[model samples]
Target: MKPGLLALVCVAFLATLPPVDAFAAPAPSLPEAGYAPLKMTIGGETRCLTADGDETKSWQYVALKACEDGSRLQNWKLKSIGNARYFIFNEYFGEKRYLRTYSKASSIALDSDTSGYSTMRSWEVSNGALNDIRLWNVYSRDIGQWKTLDADPQSQSVGISIPGGTRVDVWQYGIDMPTPQFPVAGTRKILVMATHFSDETSADSAPVRDTVLGVFGTPYYEDRSARNYLMQASGERLTPNMDFLDEVDIGERPDACNASQILSAARDAARHREKNPQDYDYLFVSIRQWRQCPWVGLASVPGNWVLAQGSSAHKFWTWTHEFGHALGFHHARILYGCPPRDGVAQLGGDCTTYNYGKAPTDPMGGGGASMFPVAYQHFAGWLSDADVPWIKHDGTYKLDPLWRRGSAAQGYRIRRSDGSVLFVEFRRPSQPFETWWGASPYVSGVTVYVVNYAPKARSMTSTLVNTTPGSGRSMGDAPLLPNHSLDDTLSGMRLTVTLAHNDGAELKVEKLPK
Candidate 1:
């Protein structure tokens, strides 16, 4: 055939094929450029991908090393090349070198060339199991070999290999992570911005403003208000000073229940009123409930913003619970259907499932107008080392009510054999706020929780232990009454409540037989 005829035939065949981008995966949402650490757990220990040197070296091998704070070698930045593909750049030498796999070697190394070898430097990223990520080299796809970035625990080396055999290393990246903001002993200024759609302006905004003021400004509801709840919960360690911005009409209805759009409009309205939203520690946006909005209240986990709709803005539990999220508290969940005697089994049993927002002893669990639990308080840095002493040996501990003022051992901590922690606290109904406990069985008793301090296990951080497994009662009746005991067979610990009174309770912690 003639050359012109052959070229024309190829063009016709190419036109019939799909576009090159048609097979590309959807791009993930990531920042244009930020410092991130690729983390993976290997051999029951957390490790991070490191550049394997103190300085920039050509062909420096990449390996999995123990994660360290302020380790520039482990810090990486992803440069997007579109289509969910990125060039991994190391931040140790100011991002001068990027990651590349050698054709003859089974390991990945740092390379400085960007003018050529596009496929060698490009990587396709996707979401993996439970907040992890999977990275596949684009060069492997060109060679018709599907391989993912894998780490070898024996060699501590990283390479591209087929997944799902004996290798189980899944990488999770933390990009521009925020510093944990614990509600310490200080006043946090809050800016409350009330907004409504143009169609919903006929309703009175005064009630909303009054509700905000009552919840955060004055003690309108006495101890039930958010201000009072925080003050008592933190033992006056944290307080709120709120400034209310006049209600603004957003001019149009939102297309859906988009929190970002609503929050942006609220912030813009605050700026119009000469109030900078950044001046306050928290930005609280209140809006009327709409049909599209599914949540009554929403908040950024460990962030400085919260949003409330309609009656949820007025409800005490909603206000405190959402703000509690802003203060870095996960949902106070309960473990159900697990063994009552073994705390470790209760935490890790495959048959057991968790119920969120069910721990009726704390506000984070949607318990009506109650203070934060002792575990949460300790996490927030509100509890001192003396307040929650670690019980290493068998002894009788005199515990005070968590809500009371005096510092007489408000809570006790026990280290389990599996590296998890057990937090034990005594609870009694405080006036005005904890009135919901009056009708519940947990009004005054000893409560225990199993806390896992792993970073990836955020959802199961603090779980309320069900003391009475077959009682057929709600989690509200989970606490141990007077003269009752809890045996943790996995931890070899037995906790017995020897005495109970209005002032406090006495718990005898003993080591059980192996």
Candidate 2:
């Protein structure tokens, strides 16, 4: 066994094994870089992907914290690794480590080795929503989900990876992103069909039809109802392109206008009317008889049906509320507990659980006076870029009534270092269709909200940073008057109402120190 003979034997044995290039030379790099000041969310909490305030720890693993848009550590860029794969690199560390997910490992970490890339370090990016995207692990092919790192007392409130169906929405920093707005020429057309109980000989569809026409159609632009406000806000009118048909009696049976028969009655009435494919955007059944108590409105169909009683109980707000669903709007308040907490349930717009409908601010909450929340406006595409301005710097600003568009800021979204947001706006309680304010007369003023943009939390996360503590009913306790302030010392953000007049309110905001 001479040295030369042994070397020749080793070379032959190595040749018998697999080639070094057999696994493929990773993936090709894409030109994606320089995008930053973004936020990563999981289960409605902002992830803290930071280097622990220690600049020397470039080798440290990335973790999730409450979102802080101001932190350079949280900013990232996805450097491509070919085959629809990418390495999510933190901008702060300059490619020192890549965010590494695993096929079997529950936690995500940072890999320091750049030369030897693993499939776990690669990700596939796909659209999550308009101008939003989701990341999938190239190895596991599972979507990225977050689990709290709370078990480690030393760990900041950040998220660690757990693979599942949850997706994160990455937003372009410092812009009031546009909400979903469809073109006006393609506005949805809906037909309103009134129905009567077979036994109720005097019920007529005229009143119901007239109400729908009056509320949703004709006077909407002038009356300043929620519908009118939406029209002014989105520039795209919600004109359901309405049509009214004669009353169709639901057959003379004891159970004739019962819960089971309403939908059928609507179907029959819809068939009885002129069939126009162009007019099929939605179908509304106005039941003329009143016997039920649940007051359940139907919205199972995406662009159809706001079936409600044709009685006196059917108010303008109620009709508008049902239309909200027809227009693809869901309940603004779902999971509810308090500001900065996960909501407990999925109650759409109903505030009975918290305040017993005493001061319902939203039409969905059974209150008529309150304007729609900013989140709803955003979802409904009611807020244009001009309506909501993103504030990354400190400033004293004037806010107009959120009900209508104005020259000043209708609303300002100030991002904190933790990635939580502050929404400041002025609310004119006397705005049209806002009659619920009479119930809590003091609600007209400047309003500030803290927004949690995670899906589970985003629904209930738009809670008011109120100036008053436990003042009115839970629904009425958000708006702040002139000279009042709501401060979040932890986030280093403070909002003060300087002047509140009919024109608008002056607000001074202090963002977190850079």
- The prediction achieving the highest lDDT against the true structure is 1
Residue by residue across 95-125, what tens digits does model 2's lDDT show?
Answer: 8777775546365666565543375676555
Q: lDDT of candidate 1?
A: 0.65
- In angstroms, how far off is 256's CA in candidate 2? 11
* Runs in model 2 lying further than 4 Å from the true structure: 1-34, 37-186, 197-202, 215-237, 250-261, 276-279, 290-293, 300-303, 310-313, 327-360, 415-421, 429-444, 450-466, 470-477, 489-491, 511-514
- Per-prediction RMSD in angstroms? 14.3, 17.6
Which candidate number would show the highest TM-score if scored against the true structure?
1
| Candidate 1 residue spans exceeding 4 A from truth | 1-185, 215-223, 337-351, 417-419, 436-440, 454-460
Tens digits of per-residue lDDT for model 1, 1-514: 0111011001000011122333122333334668778898887889988886745346677888889898888988877665445788988865577787656324567877565457778776654333466777767665656578888777767877867766655787874221111334467788877788777664455655565556334443364556667777788877778887666776677788777788888887788788898788788877887867667777654456778888677765677777766555666667555454443223234324464536777666656666777877765657655678777679899988876857479898775645456788887766767665354556567888877542211112577777764433257567777677777654567778887777888898888746
Report the Cα lDDT for residue 326, model 2: 44
